[model samples]
Target chain A: MSSQPGTVRVPQEERTRAMRARLLEATVECLVERGFSGTSTTLVSERAGVSRGAQLHHFPTKNALVVAAVEHLTEVRGAELEKAAAALPTGRRRTRAVLQMLADHFTSPVFTAALELWVAARTDETLLAAVAPLEQRVGRQTHRLTVELLGADESRPGVRELVQATLDLVRGLGLANTITDDARRRRRILDQWAVALDDALADDDLQGETA
Target chain B: MSSQPGTVRVPQEERTRAMRARLLEATVECLVERGFSGTSTTLVSERAGVSRGAQLHHFPTKNALVVAAVEHLTEVRGAELEKAAAALPTGRRRTRAVLQMLADHFTSPVFTAALELWVAARTDETLLAAVAPLEQRVGRQTHRLTVELLGADESRPGVRELVQATLDLVRGLGLANTITDDARRRRRILDQWAVALDDALADDDLQGETA
Candidate 1:
């Protein structure tokens, strides 16, 4: 009998990585479904179908587990956004497409889970300490990605502000969708913003030409 | 000394109203200071400086108390908004003033309390049923007021959507403020939005002239 590299014996490191992924995924699911208050280590372990010992070994506390899970999910979602950005259409329709892609990202399950943590963190000092820096990093990355996707020139007088407004608008739409299916209204709002954004950018181009 | 209307004797109805207002204000303070999960009836009563008996008599359950408190505060805040709208500059600066007022409203304590409820209600069926309608009414009122303040013609193409986007943007700004002050960033975003809004409205006027 001989053991092969691709045989039944999974590498210890690979097994540990897989287990942690499952736990993190389960934590996000719990956060989205039950919110922060309802999520617990035991529940996450049960949902992940991992032993309590394994869960503790991976994440010693609920705070650590949740923070890590959200960070992991945010990284995964950011990668997805980058991939989606590659598939976006070019030319006149690109502005609307970019806004739509952003709207989709904000309204996804990971965003919902993050919203729960954000609200919970508001009054939880320890959680706030952990979550605030994570949110700032995510915010900066999202802003940078948006600027790149839109080919926005921050050198323009109002272009930078316009980009920030776009992010805030999509985030607000995401919050609106949490209580109700605001998709129709969100679509209309994004359509309007797309035109405004294009006009602002066009004005910036005019300024650039004159300069 | 016969009892006089303005004298030492406060009417039973007046006293009851005052007590309830105190309790409701206290609840908002609690919700803002201590997230939804941290807020409790006992804490609310203690903060309000009202007897437990009176608190229980007024609001039998936590859900009922929080719902009523938020509703009460929203009405007060809405009235305040209406009052503030009356004093808005009626010239070139009106749009910026209107956006600023809205930004203030969304970032206020009452809105913070509503946000806590909104997040908690995501996973809470009973709270959802109670909050959804209240939020809808508030949202509609905010939109209507924005339209009126801007003198926006809904019949014009994209006018209504632009207004809705304004609300959503301000709300998103509010969400950002929850994590940190975000005031400087918010001001720049609102200023950018103000210019975009003016351009859209001006375009609508141009179309009106053509028609």
Candidate 2:
């Protein structure tokens, strides 16, 4: 295919998809670097190497862009988690690995970006309206995935709460990391929590069998 | 309490002290309501019912004002915790109460203000310079207060980790509450953690004796 004309004749569908992906990724990068208020549509477009008009065409508003980026990142993480879960073997080790995976998710740029948006949404009504529902939906999906990943019998009395606690604990750990190097502290706590979790899970299964 | 023709003749030290308290209170209020970017020297002075000159005289800069507010709030919390701790009995019930107190501190306007400063400091160099050491100092003081509040045996193998986990867990819970009405979810996790803590504390003593 020789460049016979000014147009490269790329398919519009492919072009649009590529541009959208770039813009969303740029949004994530900006958010991870500059935070919510620091991120702007122009900045996102520039970072994406896309034209301003193209950025506007893809995302009409800042809220739309940031929200879409969050959704996109969540989807990507879901897929990664699915892949990770599929590759792992069953039992106690798997549970530990899954918890580590969950910890990684909490510590990732995905969480960092979400944190900025969450903080911004606290005061920005428009952003709150845009983010709250999307976040709720993503949060529910994450909880379900986490439950599946843990492979815990949620019907058990304490199992569900333990799983939820694990998520919340990791989330708190991640939040601590944002302010400073909480890695050492987080690891120490995680080690203790892991031991407690193993005991809890064992008790849950034993109770399940007896009941 | 004179409305005399001349100066009302309040002592300079007392007047300055009162004005400083007013400004800091206003700063926390604004941070809770409007967040960091929205809270300014002007807004703080106005809400504090103090004049601009008085505000500037007390806090030389916005960073100074905000950092002082954070330090002041932490001291206020420290005093509150000391009062509560002094009134409580030395036992498991006190442990639970301490956890609740920690939770309350995480959910207060002080935490909200700190959250704003933390997020802002992520990208703002001047703010980070002012905030990092102050935050470090507060974090150390908080950890000490927490250890005292829990009455944990720090020399024991796992007891210190458990206490640290408790702080991180509560901090995570507070962060969750910032995003949504996480009170219910937080209570559920807290109940589970409390049971675990009781067991852990008991185990630590047993292990301590065995070792």
Candidate 3:
């Protein structure tokens, strides 16, 4: 490849970026498969096919690696959610569609990996410091996105709470799924929620007009 | 005290039962304070102030100790929830009162201890086998209690889901509280949900009468 005239040499910075990405990705995988306690720098480097020295150069310790992975996990999850949001259908089915998207996000591997960290962070002060802020940011982002997607009118009574309830419901369902396959029960709950949400939002619109 | 004529000698069975309770309580404490990875049989024995021989005699392994602790934790939590339910006010504010009770249960120390076990169980087959069945039983019991407390008619369409959504919402709030003091946010969400629930249940009653 270096001999080819058209092949431009990859910059050192780009190489470093690519290596870091691999390491972070591997770290998430390890966290998911092996958990926080079981995951190690050596295992991540081996999984990423990167040398131990290079892995160390990027992330000095396991905590450092996990901290970076937290950001990466949130970014990947946020991007995926955004992409799904863009593709949602309009009209009567939008509420259910939006909810389905949120549920999918919560049940994905990234969320599972995040769950591992959240549990581990509860006891580890260093990890807690990093995870708590990112969790809040991600949470606020999800809440804002849900509000926009549902076209909820926050000025109306109970609208903001309804939006929050939707997020909390799905997150709880996600937690349920972590233990067992909760798909059938989850589907029933979501279906019922969609109807209730539509009625609540429509009622709010009516109130807005009357007031 | 043993020398007193009114004081009867404790039976062997009673002594064993008391010893088991101490160990189980200590196990929950260790799980909450130290998490799953940090919890060990030796630490639990020390915390319980029980001899190593007695701890080993009761629980041969850490897994055995945790498995027993799962049942003990559920029983303790269930007993507390039932007691709280019995004291709830029955009136216009009953719905809110019930939700507050549920929230309190989810945010309690027992729930936090269960959370540690749940996260650990995700990567452990033996713990999963024990925790999963117990979790289902507890879930069903909670759901049944919620239905009874709210006087919800399951025959009404979406009532069952509403009951479940209520549970999931509170559980999610509890999860949020694990990281930060989410009491203010939780109060608002619960307040909003109480209103929404009253409306839904009332609407169901209206439909039932008109039909």
Candidate 4:
């Protein structure tokens, strides 16, 4: 391929990017399939079909690989969330859409992978140090997007808490789902919370109606 | 001590109970600190200061030990929930108290220990089988208690879901707490949800208003 006319010039940078992406993807697969203690750099490289030396070059350590994978998943989820939020019409419908997204967000592969890291970190100082910052970064970023999605007025007495509660509530439901296949019950919970959320914002919604 | 008057009787059953209790307690400590892969029968026995023979005699396999520990924790937590519920005033204030208790319940040692099992079970088939049924049992029990505590009329259109949402929201908040120390935000979420729950039950709360 390097000798082909279109690819005559070297693609070292592209190759490096592709290699790194493969390693990260494999790392997530390993993390999701095997808990923290079970995942290793060697295992990930093997899974990605990358050599040990190449994996080492891309990520200096296993922590680096795991951390990068988590960050990558976070970015992907964040973009998905932003795209979904942007597509929604801003109003009660938008608010409901955002709440629905929150309920659905943490029950996926990313959260499952993240849960492995969080639990593994409880006993591992090195992994904890690597995971804590990334976890907080994703968390704070999610909170910001959620606040926007809810269009919740923070200055209002309980409004800010209402927005935050939606995130926490959905998170709890996801955690429960990890152990139980009760998506049906979870959807009902979401419906009920949707009502509560709508009610919490009733005054604002009313003023908007009056105006 | 066993040689003393009434104590001269060597109650094998009592000794067995004490040994089993020690093993279960150590299992939780190991789970919380070492995660699933890190936890082993050897480690648990060592931590419990019980002989390997004793540990094995009590819980023949690692799966048995881990599962029993989880079941033990669930039972203890269930009893605690019942006691807390029984202590609450049977009125609107009970509803608020119940929500607060639910928020506080999942943020404790039991939930942290359970988180380890849930993540560990994600990968291990044997562990998954052991954990899933126990998880479902506790979940159903918690739901039943939550309904009673909320004094929610499940017969009402969305009321049962409201009670379930209360549990899910608190569980999510607890999951967030594991990775980050955001107690302030959790409290705010709780306060906001309390208002929403109060509103959700505004009608039932009124019947007791005359009481």
Candidate 5:
């Protein structure tokens, strides 16, 4: 609700949340069809069937709208990871589940647009501030998953590095092949993950080697 | 040179090559500034100070100009790799050199533009064909370097996996980082590579029980 006493009769939390969700969804659609630079609040509002005034009420500026869209997509990504982690038995199953979840997310507009926006964010300071934490969060989940799946030897030479590397590989593949050959792209991703996981778990005392 | 003996004088082969090279450099400049959808053949010709007819003589279509640019970049990348490779002693030294060469190539506008073009290629079939083989060449080089550096143990357990994962990581970083913090990025990359390389060389054949 607005802090102003009588700004609106029903600036209720539910209404605001619903409007934000609609705008965010519309942003994803516009981003997918027209890219980050091409997407605009006008198009997003039109697609969401919200008046331009209504859209502005929720997001005062285009940058704000873009940031919110990125944040929303990041949350979707986090939720997907959580769902996958929840379904797994424990340990390596959880790791594999996360990988599968990543592959699935790449197929969705949320992941694709979020990534393109992340790339754009590198040039846009405001957007970068919003996306950096998302990356850190994903990195933390990956590192945690690696530790659980690989057990005590997770500290071994190649384990952590392997985690970072494999994560990047899937993300790169998703960016490189998002527009075509979905099945082939997914298989390539799974293959890369399966190999990286097996390698990390098998090595011991490797962490000290590089030092 | 034109084939007909009695025809009007055609441009010399060397002149044509020089003109083509100039246009390609300009195209790369345009690509770096405008991206795939924004770059234009006329802009490239103007940048090169060549007439449109001269530009068309070398590259008849917009796609052809891009394909030529990609080809020229690939050649430059290959030469850089060879030069870097030549500086190393043997074995792992050479592989490390290869890695440095890769880092260097990525910093070049030509290679960076090619990467941007690779993403664009996902939606453009002709561009995809032009870019696919370039990736294969890089992959093949990686495979060779891994074989030479790690020897017969590549298929054993996790070796191939670790190498692939590292490749993925570097590629992703190359695409995502904008401010070009090469020193820090390079250190992170080397740290991971060293870990993977050491583990691959380690003689342990069985899964360790614990840390």
Candidate 6:
């Protein structure tokens, strides 16, 4: 063991990785309870069952921990999206599956925690750097899904607007649903979304062909 | 002088009124900076430049402070809406004015702070009690506007859905415009709302109407 101590060790690397993971998990918990601005490094370290020194060793600053948590959230969300996408049969099934995924993920606790962190990160440079790419990923994925579902590119009349509209609808629904427990109202709102999706899908270039 | 003081002992109502106004104003400042959860009575009292004893004398509790703030916000918003409505020349103009008000208010810092408070209130009993009626007021106003704009009631074919859809559009646009600062994107989103409003105004009946 003394001989191996001079070399970089796998167990130490594994321990560091575990510590990082624990820190990320603790950040989510703290975020849920105290929100982004209210959460402190000491509180996070306490919640993670790690010493302040150990937490500092893993994440030297609050910003670093925030950036790491955002990255972790994106990875978790990406995995969930992929799993949802893979479970469905191809074509329209996938389209509906994606909508369903949007509905479910937008209201989930992890997404809510991430959203608050993102909003708070508006003034935090390190977190903002992490958020920009995740936003682009969302926009690109929306564009790609529109292309596949509409069977047309950007030139398709109202397709881009429709997709953007739907995206906004999802976000609004998420925000509103989070604050209200009126189940009937929530269902009615989502039902309207499903109805609009149906109407848009069934419409046959009513605006005429775009050049 | 002592006898005059007994004779001139003014009404307790005057002192309470002044204190309520100061407390409400201070609550708004606290909310804009610290959001809902981060806000504390001690912080609020400091911001108001009042003693903690004075704050408790006025509102008595944090929940009361939040409720008073909500009512103050509504009064302020109600006045703005009334001003906008008063400026409009006719029914269509009034509708357009109201839409603009919706866009302006939702994008404002006060409303954003109010929204955070609203979200935090979901599980908070005091907040829930304060917010429920305000939500009803929103629905009632929307219903009133629908009757005015659509020229019919919800029973008409596709009319209820159309009104719901248009409200949803405004809501969606508001949320999207919050996180992103792309003016062009904002313009495109608003244009869609304008189109939906125009369509609602133009169509007399869903079966025979032409856009």
Report the number of the highest-DockQ candidate: 1
**Pairs that collide, model 4:** A169-B169, A171-B172, A172-B171, A172-B172
Tell me how far the alpha carbon of residue A37 in candidate 3 is from the true structure, in angstroms, after superposition.
1.0
lDDT by residue (A1-211, candidate 3, tens digit) is 5686344555666788888999999999988887889899999999999999988987998988987886897887888788888999999889889988998888887888888888888989998998898898888899888988888878776688789888888888898899899889888788777877787677744322345
Worst 10 residues of 5 chain B by lDDT: B202-211
- Counting clashing residue pairs in each candidate, in order, gives 0, 0, 0, 4, 3, 0
Q: What lDDT tens digits, residue by residue, belong to model 5 across residues A95-161?
A: 5566666656655677677766655665467767776776667557655764554353544555565
- Backbone clash total, candidate 2: 0
Residue-level lDDT tens digits of model 1 in A19-113: 99999999999999999999999999999999999899879999999999999999999999999999999998899999999999999999999
In Å, residue A24's CA in model 4 sits off its true spot by 0.6
lDDT winner, 1 or 5? 1
Global lDDT of each model? 0.91, 0.80, 0.85, 0.79, 0.65, 0.64
Q: Can you give the lDDT of residue B82 in candidate 4?
A: 88
lDDT of candidate 1 over B1-211, digit per residue (tens): 4656556456767899999999999999999999899999999999999999999998998989999989999899999999999999998899999999999999999889999999999999999999999999989999999999999988877888889989999999999999899999898888778877888777744222345
- Candidate 6 - CAPRI tier? acceptable
RMSD of 2: 4.4
Which stretches in model 5 have alpha-carbon errors above 4 Å?
A1-12, A91-94, A102-108, A121-160, A179-204, A207-211, B1-11, B91-97, B123-163, B179-182, B201-211
State the displacement of the C-alpha of residue A73, model 2, in Å, after optimal TM-score superposition: 1.2
Better of 3 and 5 by DockQ: 3
TM-score of each: 0.93, 0.89, 0.92, 0.89, 0.76, 0.75
lDDT of 4 by residue, A85-145 (tens): 7787775566657777877788888888888888777788998898998888887898888
Candidate 4 — what's its lDDT?
0.79
| Better TM-score candidate (3, 4) | 3
True-vs-predicted CA distance for residue A5, candidate 2, Å: 20
DockQ, all candidates in order: 0.62, 0.44, 0.54, 0.52, 0.31, 0.27
Model 5 TM-score? 0.76
Docking level of model 2: acceptable
